[model samples]
Target: MLNLVELPDPEPGDGQVLVEIDRVGVNYADTHQAENSYLSPSSLPLVPGGEVVGRTPDGRRVVALLNGGGGYAERAVADLPVAVDVPDGVDDTTALSFIVQGSTAWLLLRRSTHLEAGESVVVHAAAGGVGSIAVQLAKAWGAGRVIATASSAEKRALALELGADVAIDSRAEDMKGALIEANGGKRVDIVLDMTGGTVTDQSVASLAPFGRLGFYGMASRELPQAIGPGSLLAHSTTVAGMWLPHVFSLPGNVFSQAMGELFELAAAGTVRAVDGGVYGLSEARAAHEALRSRGTTGKLTLDPSR
Candidate 1:
C-alpha cells in the first residue's frame, strides 16, 4: 500500500536540496500518521516518513528532514539549513536513525536540561528508538546514574546493556521508588519522558529540586495530566516540551553546531544506532502494525531499494 502511488520528484526551490532517498527512518510518528492519530494530520494518501538518509544528485551522502510526508518513496526535498553531511563510516541505515532520535537525545542531554557529569537522569521507554539513544547519550554526557523504565524483562535487560545503571519494570513496579533507590535516595536531576498519562505524574514526583522534566512524545496515547497544585511549588521542578524541528529552526549556526556534535558522537561509537528492524518500502503497513503492537525494541527503517 505504501508504494501503490508514486509521488512526483520534488524540485529544490531557493535554498533547498533534492535528495534521492536510500533509507528512511520509521518512527512512532509514522505509526501515528498511518493510524491518523498524529499530532498534525497529513493529507490523505500522503507518504509517511519524517527523516531520510540519502545522497545528493552529485553523490554526496547526506541526512535530511522532510517537511511533508515523502520519505517512503524514491526522492525527497529538504531545506539546506536542516540538512547535514553524513559522517564517514556512517551507513544509510545508521544515518537515518541518527538524524532524528540521536539529535533529540543530544539536544535534551547537552542543551535542553544542561545535564552534567555526576547528575542522574531517568528515561522512560528505555528500550525504544529514542529511549535507547537517550540511555547511551546520558552516559556519554557523564551522567552518574542512568535509570530506565520498560514494560518487559527483555527490554529492561536491553536498557541495562545500553548503559543504564538500573532498569525497572514500569508496569509492575513503583517507578518513583525504583528511581529513588537507583539514585541513592536522592531524586533524579532530570526525567526524559516520551510516555504521557500517569507516567507524567510519576516523572514529576521523581524530580529533584530545580530538576527539569523534558517531554518529547506521547507514546502512552494520552495527554499529560495536570500536576497537583502544591507539587510544582514544593519541588521547584520545570517541565520542558521539546520538538526537534523547532530546535533546528533557530537562527545562526545553532542547528549546525548541534548536529555536528551528535554526528561526532555517533562516529566515535559513544552513541549507537538502534535500528532493530528494516523493512521494504512496500511493507510499510506491516511496519506500522509492528510499531503499534509495541513489541519491537528499537528503531525501524525502510529501504526504498527493496
Candidate 2:
C-alpha cells in the first residue's frame, strides 16, 4: 500500500509559499468542492480544501488561504501574501479553523456591516464554524444582542455556549418572529447569512431600516434567488457578498492588518475555536461524508499526522 501519494509539489515560483500542512480545516466549501458544486470551477481529481495551518521551512507556524483546492494533503503551495504567521500559543487545529471562517466573520462584522457597539446581529447556522465564531465576535464587538439560528436544540445550546444571546430553532418556527422576540421587537442591524434560498429572504425581512446583510455561503446548496430592488428599496436595506479571497486581493497592508486583528482576538481568548472533531488525512472521505450529512458542528479538521 502506498502510504503517501506524490502529486505536483510545484515550487513557489513567485509570490507563493510552500507549506507542509499540519491541519486542514474542513468547511461547507470543502463539501461543495467534493460534490463538484463549488462556485469556482475546479480541476478534476483535485485535493479539496480551503485553509490550512502549516509550518514554513523556517520552522514558523503559518496559516494559508489557498487560491484553489489542495489542502487535503501533507503539503501544498499557497500564495505568499495570503499566508500569515500563526499567533503563538494558538494550536494547529484552532489556527487552521480561524484563517478562513474567522477572518470572514471579522471582515463582515467590522468592515462590511460596520456593526455598531449596541446594534443587533443575526447569524445563521450559528453552531457551525463561521457562525459560531461570528456570534462570539459579535458579542465581543459589543452587539447588544446576538441571535443565532440553528436547526436543532443541541446546536442551539451550543451557539448559546459560544456566546449567542439567544438561539432560535430556524426549522421549527417563523424566523422573523423568533428574531423579533429575541430583540424585544427591534429589527436587527445586520444579518450574516450562509444559508441561501428562502433563508436569505427571511434574513432580508428581519433587518431594520438601512440595515446591512452580508451573504457568505450557500449552505443549503442552492443558489440564492435575487432579492428584488423594489423590496430592498422598500426596506432601505443593503446586501453585500463576502468572500475571503477577495479581501486578500487588495493591495498594500490590507490583508496583513486584518489577519493581525483576528490573531490578536484569538490569542486573547475573545474568539474561541469551535473545533468539532479531528480526522486523519487518510480519512478525508469520511470527513466529507460527515460534513455532507450535517451531523457535526463547529470546525472539522484533517490531522496530517493521524
Candidate 3:
C-alpha cells in the first residue's frame, strides 16, 4: 500500500504554512495509520507522516506537527501554531524528534507521574523512539533508579548509556524477576509500559505500594487483559493510559509549555535525539519495514532531497 507519486506542489491554506521539509520522522504511529489501526484512522489517499523539521517561506527553521499526513513530500503544510522555531543547537532530525516522541516523553514524566527524586522507574522498550527519550528525561528529572527493558543486549546497553540505572532483557524468560531484582529486589515506583498484553500484568505486579504505571502504546500488537479493582487492591497501584492525539486537543498553555520545555531540554543537552537512520523519501517502504522489524533504535528519519 506504500507508493511514491509525483503531484503538484501543495499550497498552504488559511492558518497553515507550507514548509520545505528537511527531515521527516518515521513513527510507529505511522504504522497504525498505514494499517488503518490508528485511533483516528487515516482517510483514503493520505500521505502518511506526522512530524517534520523544515523551513518556512521566511527561511525560519522549525519543527512541525501534521495530523492529517503530508510530511513525506518535499513540501508539507502545517498549522502555524504547530510549527515552531527550532533552537540553535538542535538539528533538523533532532528538532523533528520533539513534536511527538519528545513531547510525549515530557508529558509522561512531567505531567503524568510527578516523579520525584529517589523514585525508581521502569521504561519498557527503553531504547525505542519514545522510550529512548523517556529514559533520558527520567534521569534528567531525577529518577533515583531507572530500569530499562529491551529485546536485545545491544538495546539494553543502549538504554544504560542513555541514563538507565539498570537494563533488562524484556524477552528473558524471567523478565519480571530480573526487573524486580534490578529494582532492589522490589517493585518499582513507576512503570512506563508501551508494550501492553503480558507486560501490562507484569508491570502492575512489578509496582510497589502506591506505584503508578503509565500505559501509552501497544507496539506488541496484543490487547492487554482488563485491569479490575481486584488487580490493584493489594498494592493500591494505579494504571493510566494516554493518547497523545487527545492530549494535543486540549485548549490551553499546558500543551505549549510542555513543548517549550522539550525544546529547552534539547538545547541544554539534557536529552538528544538518537538517529536509527535517514532514508530517502522514496525509501519509505524500507523505512516502515525497519520500524516493523522492531530491530531499530532511536528515531528514523526520511529525507526527500536524497
- RMSD per prediction, one decimal? 1.8, 2.4, 1.4
Write the residue-wise lDDT of candidate 2 on 1-306 in tens digits: 113356776577688888998889988888777777777876666778878888888787899888787888888888887788887788876777678888788888977899999999999889888888899999998998999988889999999998888898877457777777788888888999988887888778878899899999887877666588987997799999987778856677766776787778888878888878999888888887887676788889988887
Candidate 3 worst ten-residue window by lDDT: 246-255
Candidate 3 segments exceeding 4 Å error: none
Alpha-carbon RMSD, candidate 1: 1.8
Global lDDT scores for all candidate models:
0.82, 0.83, 0.86
TM-score of each: 0.93, 0.93, 0.96
State model 2's lDDT. 0.83
Candidate 3, residues 192-286: lDDT per residue as tens digits? 98787888877888788999888888888887785679888878988878878777667785667877888888878788888888999999989
List, in order, the clash count of every candidate structure: 0, 0, 0
User: Residue 63 CA error for candidate 3 (Å)?
Assistant: 0.4
RMSD of 2: 2.4
Worst 10 residues of 1 by lDDT: 1-10
Q: lDDT of model 3 at residue 289?
A: 87
Q: Higher-TM-score candidate among 2 and 3? A: 3
Ranking by lDDT: 3, 2, 1
Candidate 1, position 248, lDDT: 56
